[model samples]
Target: MLHKTELEYDANNHLFLDAYHDDAQPYLGLLIDIHGGGWFRGDKDKDADWATRLAQLGYEVLVPNYRLTPQVFYPEPLRDMDTLMTWIATSDFNQMPIGVVGSSAGGNMAVELAIRYGVPAVSLSGILDIDDWLTQHQAVEAAPGDLDRFNQQSSAAINQTGSNDAFYKWFVLNYFNQRTDELSAATPVHRISATTGPLFLANSLAEFVPTSGVLKLADALTSVQVPFVLNVLPGNRHAKGYLDDIFSQITAFLATYLIDQRPKPQLATE
Candidate 1:
């Protein structure tokens, strides 16, 4: 069974949740699905197909709609996500451990949330570094408004005092929240502590954003002694088979971590 409901967020942000059930036994607490649109466009509706599949597996899923770029910049989405998670924690569906799933831009944000909140997360070809992305976008030499309508926050930060790397003067600012250190802090690898939960990150070697981002995150996780799993499929799309693989692992992971369906003690031999 699947049900849809609206969730409230800071400043009248209306997020939606798609509830799923199968066999009645709770296999998960709550699942959050974030849509990717380069931080500029995209909606929860696009994630419906994936959410629906997860719901059929008996997990409650929330697909949040956030204010896109040109209207709001970095940190806003993070705040929006925080508000949604807090609401879920206090809501009736707050029974099971929360597992967040994200792809592309959303994947990047998902890693940040999991790290910041100490929740389990699965990132599909997540974009970990905004600086790197902007470099690829060629926003540095391009005219303003090429990347974002707002002031180039990232570019300005990197070259505040007019340091070299002329191209660095036009970095992607919306995602980094105008803070370089925040990038380091928000990164899943940086957030990894002994308390950090398990993570499953998959990327395609052919995809620059997801592939390089996953590599960076994996390296950081190694340095911090955090438990994480990385899967790189050569010649694959960013979100290729994402719904299938993510849902499968999430189901089993939830069963192992949340349900605790241990066997009952057997009666003494008669």
Candidate 2:
């Protein structure tokens, strides 16, 4: 009952849209799936099953492969997703409400996308602030093994083009751009505004990404009165096995929030 297809992309290499629709009728809605492998590894195929389930629910789906770490960094991922959303607004998918679902780093990107572009987002334990890990401050220290994984997988490593210290400087410079103001720019906490769109957050109580990040995000949304939902699932391991109950809750949330909003009109402009 679902049809699959690819989305042609532009020269910037910002977007790739893989879609699914019903065989007998047109697509009723769309969800963009952003995979999370700590911003370094993850692809559309890895998320196809999630997309497929949404498609089965009568919503079209797009799983885009964006520039990854060790190749691109920071704003590149956010920019890629933003451009893709703009492109989607002009495709056949135009005229339907758009929703995005991201995990881990992708979850961070999802919240950032909604903050910067006004797209509705559903994040499953996403990294909301890069500074929570990058800035070598006296924050909650990561365990030794976890720190090793962080070093290898953090988006900052994408720009490691020189010696260790130099690469770190490049990562920090590229991220903060030599200005203190830019620090906030790179942090989703700094981007929150009253106009920010809806966010549905799901966090594993056991995940070390910090419950505080989710709490901070939820507080901001609440302060600004942006429509949002937060689900803290206790005892679940860090983004562990596909919990069907969580998935069902996510699908229901998307259906309720996205079912009626209209997509952009796709009339070609000469």
Candidate 3:
């Protein structure tokens, strides 16, 4: 919690982000931290610890916030996340070798960025496949007519154990608006390809998202021959910590992929 620093940003929706970096180095790579809060109710505070730790590990970190539901929905947040990524990339904000890390809602975005931008990333207990997630919610009443009915149904879903039902319900309704037709555009697994970057995925088999989803993502990555690893923790599906026990391996993985990745010079051409 010490040696913390924050940066100011205005996303034009009254949304802002707190940025931090390894000030010890004049120039450094970047790790963008996205906090998980059911996509509708979380902020950078959720991942500040992660940002701080990544900074200690010698990477500049950017933890951002996105405009959410009621005013906007699914694709909007995706665009917001992309805007931050693009800003960093073009600005070259003082470094190179950019990467992403997210948990829960944020985890989904991190994986999406990895797919979209082709950069190394990690997702902890992420809701990567949303259509599948809704199918598994068990409590969500599909397309509950109007917003009032939708809210009522989701209110019940909010109580489903380990489901994190409220967030799931809101994310869907806010985006698709009462339509259960399909979520192809929002699902990350369907978009994975050989060009996707290396990934480190971890999940706890408890509440919130399904462990099976994590395995499915891992399976897809393996099938494509993309370099990636999956770590399954005991039983805590909704767990997230960048400075906890599991982070040790995460650190090692990213250190190799993000920090150490640089072009090697060919033997001196005489």
The candidate maximizing lDDT is 3
Q: Candidate 3, TM-score vs. the true structure?
A: 0.81
Report the lDDT tens digits of candidate 3 across residue range 119-143.
8888887777667777767586533
On the 0 to 100 scale, the lDDT of residue 214 in model 1 is: 78
Sort by TM-score, top down from the best: 3, 2, 1
Taken over the whole model, the C-alpha lDDT of each candidate is 0.62, 0.67, 0.69
lDDT of 1 by residue, 127-186 (tens): 675555444655345222333421221111211222222222222454554556555445
List the candidate numbers ranked by lDDT, top first. 3, 2, 1
lDDT of 3: 0.69
Best by TM-score: 3
Higher TM-score: candidate 1 or 2? 2
Off by over 4 Å in 1: 14-27, 132-188, 240-242, 245-247, 257-270
State residue 122's C-alpha deviation in candidate 2, in Å: 0.3
Alpha-carbon RMSD, candidate 1: 8.0
